[model samples]
Target: MSERITRLEEQVAYLTKTVEDLSDVIARQDRELDQIKRRTQMLMEREAQRDLDEGGSVPLADQKPPHW
Candidate 1:
C-alpha cells in the first residue's frame, strides 16, 4: 500500500543519515590515530637518544637476578 511505501522510504532516509554520520566519525578517528602514532614514535626516539646520552649501561630490567 501507499502508506507502507512511505514508511519504508522514511526508514531508508534515516539509515542513510546515520551512515553518513558514522562515516564522518570514522574519518576523524583515523586522523587522530595517525597523530598519536607519530607522537609515540617521536617520544620513543627521544628516549632512546637520552639513554645513549646518559650511558649505554644495562637497564635494571635487563640485570640478572640478585640471588645469582
Candidate 2:
C-alpha cells in the first residue's frame, strides 16, 4: 500500500512538471506567433505602399462606382 502510494505520488509530480513545461512551451509559441503576425502586417503595409507608388489601382469592377 505504501509503495503504491509513493509511486502514484511520483507520477503525479512528474505529470505536474510536464504540464508546467508544456505551458512554457505554449507561451513561447504564442510569443512567436505574435511576432510573426506583426512582421507579416509590416510586410503587407510595405507592399501596399509600393503598389501605390507604382500607380497600382484596384480594378473598376472591384471598386465602387465613380458616382460614389
Candidate 3:
C-alpha cells in the first residue's frame, strides 16, 4: 500500500508540473498575439494616412475595386 501511494504521489507531481508549464506557454503566446495585433493595426493606419497624403480624394481603403 505504501508503494502504491508513493507512485500516485509521483504521478500527481508530474502532472502538476506539466500543467504549470502549459500555463506559462499559453501566457507567452497571448502576449505575442497582442503584439502582433497592435503592429498590424499600426501598419494599416499608416497605409491609410499615406494614401491620403498622396492627394487621393478617397483613401484606397474606401474606394471600390477596379473590377467594380
Candidate 4:
C-alpha cells in the first residue's frame, strides 16, 4: 500500500509539472499570436492606404477574381 501511494504521488507530480509546462507554452503562443495579429492589421491598413493613393476605385481586396 505504501509503494502504491508513492507511485501515485510521483505520477501526480509529473502530471502537475506537465500541466505547468503546457500552460507556459500556451501563454507564450498567445503573446506571439497577438503580435502577429497586430502586424497583420498594420500591413492591411498600409495596403489599403496605398491602394487609395494609387487612384484605385476598388481596393484589390474588394475586387472579384478574374475568373468570374
Candidate 5:
C-alpha cells in the first residue's frame, strides 16, 4: 500500500510540473500573437494611407492577376 501511494505521489508531481511548463508556453505564445496582431494592423493602416496618397495611380503590385 505504501508503494502504491509513493507511485501516485510521483505521478502527481510529474503531472503538476508538466502543467506548469505548458502554462508558461501558452503565456509566451499569447504575447507573441499580440505583437503580430499589432504589426499587421500597423502595416494595413500604412497601406491604406499610401493608397489614398496615390489615388487613381495603382502601382503594378496593386494590379489584378493575369487570371482575372
Candidate 6:
C-alpha cells in the first residue's frame, strides 16, 4: 500500500510539472498573438490613411492632360 502511494505521488508531481510548462508556453503564444494583432492593425491604419490622403477618389478622363 505504501508503494502504491509513492507511485501516485510521483505521478502527481510529473503532472504538475507538465501543467506548469504548458501554462508558460500558452502565455508566450498569447504574447506573440497580441504583437501580431497590433502590427496588423497599425499597417491597416497606415494604408487607410494613405488612401484618404490621395483624395479618396479618381478623376474623370477629361481631367487628364492634352497628351491624350
TM per prediction: 0.80, 0.83, 0.79, 0.83, 0.79, 0.76
Q: Candidate 6: which stretches are off by over 4 Å?
A: 57-68
Q: Taking the tens digit of each residue's C-alpha lDDT, what string does model 5 give over 1-68?
A: 99999999999999999999999999999999999999998997688779879784555676798999
Candidate 2 per-residue C-alpha lDDT over 5-33 given as tens digits, one digit per residue, 9 for 90 to 100: 99999999999999999999999999999
Q: Write the per-residue lDDT of candidate 3 for residues 1-67, one digit (tens) a residue.
A: 9999999999999999999999999999999999999999999888888878998667666789999
TM-score of 4: 0.83
After superposition, which runs of candidate 3 have C-alpha atoms over 4 Å from their true positions?
57-68
Q: Note the residue pairs that clash in candidate 2.
A: none
lDDT of 4 at 23: 100
Please, what are the lDDT tens digits per residue for candidate 6 over residues 1-68?
99999999999999999999999999999999999999998997777778668877433432567785
Model 1 Cα lDDT, one tens digit per residue, 1-68: 99999999999999999999999999999999999999998997777768878987655655698899
Q: What is the lDDT of residue 38 in candidate 2?
A: 100
lDDT of 1: 0.89
C-alpha lDDT values of all predictions:
0.89, 0.89, 0.92, 0.93, 0.89, 0.85
- For model 4, the superposed segments whose C-alpha errors exceed 4 Å read 58-68
Summarize candidate 4's per-residue lDDT along 28-68 as a digit string, tens digits.
Answer: 99999999999999998888879789986667677799999
Off by over 4 Å in 2: 58-68
Clashes of each: 0, 0, 0, 0, 0, 0
Maximum-lDDT candidate: 4
Model 5 scores worst on lDDT over the 10 consecutive residues at 54-63
What's model 6's TM-score? 0.76
